[model samples]
Target: MTSKNEITVTGGRLYYEVRGDGPLLLAMGSPMGADAFAPLADALADRFTVVTHDPRGISRSALDDPREDSTPRLRAEDVVAILDDLGAETADVFGSSGGAMTTLALAARHPGRIRTVVAHEPPTLNLLPDAVDRHAEVDEIVKTFETDGLEAAWRMFLSTSGYQEDEAGPPPSDSPEQDLEDGRRFFVHELRETTRYIPDLDALRDGPFRVVVGLGADSGGLLTRRTCAALADELGVPVVEFPGDHGGFIWDPEGFAKLLGDILMTENVRIPLARV
Candidate 1:
């Protein structure tokens, strides 16, 4: 059973949920929020004490300063705050999309707090060979939101990500205006900082924590998939394929959880962790 709770951190109040019993495992997102990870958390709860939360300034986690930009570094610190509140000295982390970037940053910033991090397709645009063009494209998306609207900007974003409308199945929405508002905040307040983040690879490499970069088996040639592989290469490891595309955990939560458990059981990470 999942239990809900809250904690105040920096400029916001974070709402988080915990379920099951065993080693601590955190499943996270950025603007995607706590609700997005519900199914995945439920699936993994049998093996782990799964925790999920809404990142500050998103959904239930309201920020004191809405205008404060959400940076990867800031989000990473928020994750640490959640851990600190839970009294968990360390946790295995599973971060999807922008959350994956948070996982990397958290591991870099607080090496001893993470046991292993499964980064599922973090779109770190700076790592791409055509980074200049990518940044311009993202800027255009933001501009489209400013001038046209969220739908137009989202269409451009989907198209640029090598996905069409059908692929991005419409989410259940009670209010289109609220959805649009969230999208606007994501693009304006969150996207640029997240995409521009250059990870501290030296820290990740030298730290005691293990980082596992993952992508979906059917992701094929998606931009995020390419970047995922790039990051794995940088970490001197091969990309571990989960069951589906970027949102694989949602598509096949049981399978994803099983794979995640299998990864944690892998011999490479079996050695005792050195305290940071």
Candidate 2:
């Protein structure tokens, strides 16, 4: 059974969902929210008490001030609040895209809160050699959103991130209004803060929790694949490959859940290619 709830944070209220019945596992995404992970959470419910949430200022989560920009640190703190609310001392976390950056921050800032972290395709542009250029590109994308509009901004974003229109998949929301709200929050308030976040490599390297950087097997030439490789290299851990591209888990939740279970259950196990 799924239970829906909300908790107050410093400057906002976070909406979250809990389901299933075992050790806690958080399936998270920024701007993606709880609904995006419902399929994967359901697939893993038999073995884990999965939790999913809307990050502050996104979807169901509401911020006190709509103008306040979200940073990785703030989002990390929100995760801590969710754990505290759930009465969980620690949880296994799976964070994708911007959410991956939030998990990395959580591991660094709150050491014992995470048992293991699977960071899938974090857009840690700061870790790349061409970071400055990439950040500038992101700035341009934001500017385009503010000027040219959403569709134009998305086209530029997809092209810059190495995803073709077909490969990037469908829009996150079927409703135009919902899409506009989500896109604005991301491009304006969250994008720069997330991509520009510099992970505390020292803390992650020496922290108590295990950190696993995940790359999509079909994510060749993608910006996030490069970022994931950079993170794995820094952490001295192997990059675990998953099925499909960046949105692999969404595309094939059952197959993705199986692989995730394997990684979480065993230590240093070889990741076999999963066919969705």
Candidate 3:
């Protein structure tokens, strides 16, 4: 169901996997490794040459120099490096969570290298005119990861994210220590630099690449979904609605893959596909 490979990039080596063999769709998972996308990858592989990889510092990707940590621009460049190493001049891309933020950067900074981009729920708090304070709050949470640990940071995060103060309960894995470490070591570096992130929409429009803003049908009014709607309105296109929530690709990978299969295939459909 999966095929694995490796590619060398600046400052590190990437562990990658290929699933299908069509129009080269590159998928980046949330902070978790590409393995999180296993379900979607299998579903799409038959129709497209699907590619997924661990980001620079996670999983099998080796960072030769620990001092190589950096900004989102550097992470976006890693995506570009992966494509180049695979001999792909350009490809369609789908990025979620922090990965979605990375996708926007790629489109804005390297427009000529992407055919199309779908950025789902990028969590661009800096984009919302009313959400600037929320950005600062999350930044503090990132700081907590440095001072406190993952559990405290996550508790604060879930509480702020409408997790309903123990109403929804803790993650099944519930390893606060592990979470704290991951946040301090990996997320703090990636997310803190990403907080005030806002993409140049003007540049996105002028670029040749087609853009689709995704909102999870189940996510409702979450900041990321609203942000997607705002962007779709600005771009003069219908919001591309998909199944599931912020982490839909992981929660409902089978259904998510089916939805994605349609999105990637029905680009030319007459009726704007609507999800109820």
Which candidate has the top score in lDDT? 2
**TM-scores vs. true structure, each candidate:** 0.94, 0.96, 0.87
lDDT per residue for candidate 3 within 216-274, as digits (tens), equals 87777466766676666666667776777777787787777776766777777542333
Candidate 1 residue 90 Cα shift, in angstroms, is 0.6
- The lDDT per prediction is 0.83, 0.89, 0.73
User: What is candidate 2's CA lDDT for residue 244?
Assistant: 78
Model 2 alpha-carbon miss at residue 226, Å: 0.9
TM-score of 2: 0.96
Worst 10 residues of 1 by lDDT: 267-276
**Candidate with the larger lDDT of 1 and 2:** 2
Q: Write the per-residue lDDT of candidate 2 for residues 1-276, one digit (tens) a residue.
A: 999999999898999999999889998988688998999999999989999999999888989998889898999999999999988899999999989999999999999898999999999898899999999999999999999998888889888999976654335676778778878898999999899899999999999999988888888878888898788889998788888788888889999999998788787777863221
The positional error of residue 106 in candidate 2, measured at the CA in angstroms, is 0.4
Worst 10-residue lDDT window for candidate 3 reads: 167-176
Q: Flag regions of model 3 displaced more than 4 Å.
A: 67-70, 166-181, 270-276
